[model samples]
Target: MQQAINKVELRNLQIEDYKELKNSMVEAYSELKEAYWQEEQIERLLEIFPEGQLVILVDGRVVGSALSLIVDNRKASATHTYEKITGNYTFSTHDPFGDVLYGIDVFIHPDYRGLRLGRRLYDARKEICEKLNLQSIIFAGRIPRYAEHAKEMTPKQYIEKVRAKEIHDPVLSFQLSNDFHVIKVMKNYLEGDVSSQEYAVLLEWNNIYYEKHQQLINTRKSVIRLGLIQWQMRPLNNLEALFEQAEFFIDAVSGYASDFAMFPELFIAPLMADYNHLSEADAIRELARYTDSIRKKFQEFAISYNINIITGSMPLLENGNLYNVGFLCKRDGTSEMYSKIHITPNEVFYWGMKGGSQIKTFDTDCGKIGIMICYDVEFPELSRLLADEGMDILFVPFLTDTQNGYTRVRNCAQARAIENECYVAIAGCVGNLPKVNNMDIQFAQAAVFTPSDFAFPTNGIKAEATPNTEMTLIVDVDVDLLKELHEHGSVRTMKDRRKDLYQIKKLKS
Candidate 1:
């Protein structure tokens, strides 16, 4: 009466293991008439992608197996039937350079079902997916229990019930618990899947680390560090004083290895102290004179400090009309300007500011980004347009006179992050400039926001500066999480848009 030796191992499937693998597959799917893979089919899978074919052994016996193949999703779409995906068991749809790893089969022997061997096989596939840098792991999961409820409800209804835990579907429940989300309910997916009534679900598990191009896999950054300046507004004696203060924050943020440093909108308004005697309109016009010098000095700081700088909003006097403009000074010596698209009534009355018509996202070493001034971020359409351009981050530089104004900017910015599925970093000026008429009595709380999901903070606020305080808030955010949310989040706002009913279009004016 000696106890049986217990041992477990997981590895790539060898050709000699085919017999045991087929036996395990048959025993696991005993309800199906044709449940085992042919010897030649297993050989072909090994020939095409040996690394993708995995098997788990318990005490020198094949107890579980998982089969997968790389596929060009464009050609073998998730909606394609099992026969088409597998080329009628010939596995001709397999493409070594494809972006998705398609799971064709996974089973654990009925004897080993309670041991969580199926989970091990699924986990192993995910590890292989990440190692190969595939965009995601996709599979047509069978809803075997659907047949029981098919007479009473549709496949979709059945799926919803299973998702809500109102129904217990062995396979679907297992997949849902493992972080695999059902993209859609696929019909007639497999011919002999009688228990599933020829129905299946297109399930996907996105690999957050996936890079579209293999060459840039190591070069592209996942985590981007942001440095936001809760700038204190005070009277400045001269242009040198403003530049010195700007350089001080830049030097400090760069020292902390921040990728981008953002200053609050109209941070240079304090320099208008010398023009306090002039009217509000005339004084801001005079402040616009330093736009060129500030641009040059910030660009210099960008290159010297090796950190990208967002110059906030400065008055630009162009063609006798004033506009609030900002500069994106890349550390590589390249610079781009974005003008405020939405002008506040106060800006029009006091400064006679005219809104700019153009809006676009800028490309930076860290990622593609869009800049919006105080009033601009409050408009949902503008940020949505930027998000359409694949913008990873939306930087909003604001100057608010009171808590009510800051609340508008803060709430809208947070909404943009959640709806657009992107990061929003907002910095604003605090303190007061009593000498400058329109710039007096500022209130702000600089903060960074992220898409609301399990991957991000519960409240969606990454970091925030103390209210109406002069401080720098530094936070690190992963751009990869946004990609995952776009494809496989709890609620995919981008993908679930009802485009047929209505659409958001940029009109050519």
Candidate 2:
């Protein structure tokens, strides 16, 4: 039988708490008869990394404890025995520069079992992970009931059953519910462990919000180069001419060694040269017809130049309706698309396009990013939502016919960067589309924006091109700097946000 805690106190481990912690450890492991760390070894762990050690108390008496140590991931990722990893229970493997927080041990006093004290201790560990910006919490979990099924199943098969929910093991089941995923099974991980039969399951809980790795976090600052194109509008005499013009810009941008190249909204307008005589509505419908070919070409160019490309946006007809879509083609021949979420008045009334409902954040080789087209960037909620999902950069492809229209996008984009503490890049069409009605009058500029903080440019503008010009602006953006701004900026906007007063509600789909 277990008793509930009437009062509990949680804090860092002190030399005075060691005696009580050892007593609780002995009582908790009495049934399993596992080896326990001696008083001197436990004290050594506290000396090396006290921030990683915690103890829980009820009414001035220790009832539970959680021990952890930071270790260089390179060495931890290699195969090793328990003694070698833990430094004979002294946690000598501690590394200050490490990104991973390795769990040393966790146990609840027998009398406190089933009162959820263990859960509270685990939550404390997660808080530590966030505070220190650790990549993950890795530990080997014991399959406590393995000996019961050992005669009928191999250790692997036993784990498979546990994962399938066909059989429940005390340790692994509790770990899985706490967001830990199984990595692999280790053989001879522990000695004199009859309960687990000398086998352990490797588990990890990845910190999705962890600041990027050391190389990206260092002072040198790694940069992701961007090439923004302000495509010139000209009638395409033939399909071959369109491909040739597209290849020309691709070659030009590739020559600059850019990691990513982005085109302006409706960059495909010239491809509609043959159907210029059609009505505004009919011309957009005709433009939608090239969606397939344009997607294929976007992928082809992205692969050929070994660069990621955001192919502005094009009108597409889907299920008897129309949508404005942007395709992101990766250098690896893979691609993803995001539909315009907030349609402009001209888009709804003249172009006859519908706004998309869903929002998406993409995971790229460089970092996590998002795509918002034109009017979509004007809404603060959309960008905030993506920011909450770990988006570091936002790409906006826009088109505006007047100075006021361009200003609206430019201003709102800058606001989004400041509010969300993220980087925003805006590329817009800047020339005449004389043949296309509704889209003919173009006024725009291409600019890359950063958060308004000391770590970024004083003006928050990374790069900008002249308005109403046909040009491409290539700039190098340091993504790691975004991490610094989030944590140590003069004004920590993300951390200082008042969440208790109000929150943006996301409706159920």
Candidate 3:
């Protein structure tokens, strides 16, 4: 679908369709006097299972088919580049693999020339590469060059002379138009065109092809302010009025990609009067309903605005037990939820609940991000585990006390970011929600953190709820930069890790 124009339907080649495809390829190869066509080869190809061999069909006929080569080097040297490149390297330059070595074989019936079936067949091959985990697909194709006139020469001399001939031709124009590079050439060794013992030009499609493949990957790199919108709201009553203050903040940042949005510790509270007086069973049941609703509503707003939201601590119920939680669902449908892995002594003492143990990270179209809850972030292991998994952005949602606790969390955030070479976001609830007996005080402000080893220029912050209001904060992420930090270059963090000695220590465990 990327830059497509024709109506060619591509599907796996069936055995029933094989007769037509093999017949077409053999005939096409015959034109060049190549001996690759044979009945024995067809039988071997059948062993691959026709369902896996793909065909490019137009109308009801098979115009093109790919004869793939499978090389399983599991019993031999398996880690070499050549072994990895051409899955199970079959040196046979005859049937399908030869075509693979020569690049994907595309023989459009001469009648279907202008229909653009060539590109469709190539896409089929790319899919094959993905299933096998091939790093990069390389194509080897022939370019034609003709000599001006014949001359007296010996067998080798004649072939060498023919190879020496050079011409700026039409197919050569076609190949270059498609971004193929001319790597080399030969004599009397290619399919189609004037053999006249003519020169065979070798062309390839490498990473530089750039023929509309990467166009769909949102490459827009505009700097946008992102907010860790943590609100200090007491509780949501009647869900509507409770959302009033939070909605006001979202409305203000509504128009721009730069907006502030957030959710605090238990944004919704039941009956708002005396929570402590309620039995634990009743309290947990009410919180469970609130958690499910919060997840649904939070997803809608994030998707509707195409914004980034770190929905703060909600009550998550797994089985019948309830735990505090955090979520970061981008404006897209992609959502990630993190249960509180570390519990405060007070919470455990009072609620008699356990904590989450695993650290989960989500890969977004934007970047690789991880979430840790309130008290869990204090432990170095939580962030360390996420860092080990290649997290580029880490979000920590907490219920902070009046001191704002920015410096405290920010310190931990900075440490984690520096250790992992990633960015960190910490959001905290801002107000006190008092029920019959006890007051649950949540800190109000959130902060953004970057690796301390590098310069941050204080990246833009989205509109977070102010000192007193509940709000939704939105921010744009610079995913491109995050990608760079993960890969190699001047500041390649992954490369900076000396895994040899580190692996020994880890292996001991």
Candidate closest to the true structure, highest lDDT: 1
TM-score of each: 0.80, 0.61, 0.51
Error of 2 at 16 (Å): 32
The Cα error of candidate 3 at residue 427, in Å, is 1.6
lDDT of 2 by residue, 452-479 (tens): 8777889999989987888888888887
For every candidate, C-alpha RMSD to the true structure in Å: 5.0, 12.7, 15.2
Q: What is the lDDT of every predicted structure here?
A: 0.91, 0.84, 0.55
Task: Write down the lDDT that model 2 would get.
Answer: 0.84
Off by over 4 Å in 3: 1-212, 217-225, 258-261, 269-276, 279-285, 334-336, 402-407, 434-440, 453-455, 458-477, 483-493, 503-509
How far is 389's C-alpha from truth in model 3 (Å)?
3.4
Deviating ranges (above 4 Å) for candidate 2 = 1-221
Best by TM-score: 1
TM-score of 3: 0.51
lDDT of 3 by residue, 1-509 (tens): 22443456788765677667766676655556552434545554556534335777766677776655533323111222322333423334223322222343456665566666766665666556544433334433333333333355433343344344433443454555453555544444432445334444455443211222334567433243555555655545565665566555555565555532555555554334434567654565565666666667767777777666667776666786768776776777666777787777766665556686556677654455677776666777667667776676777776665563555665676677666766666666566666622345655556666653223434423223455445545555554455445542346555576786663112211
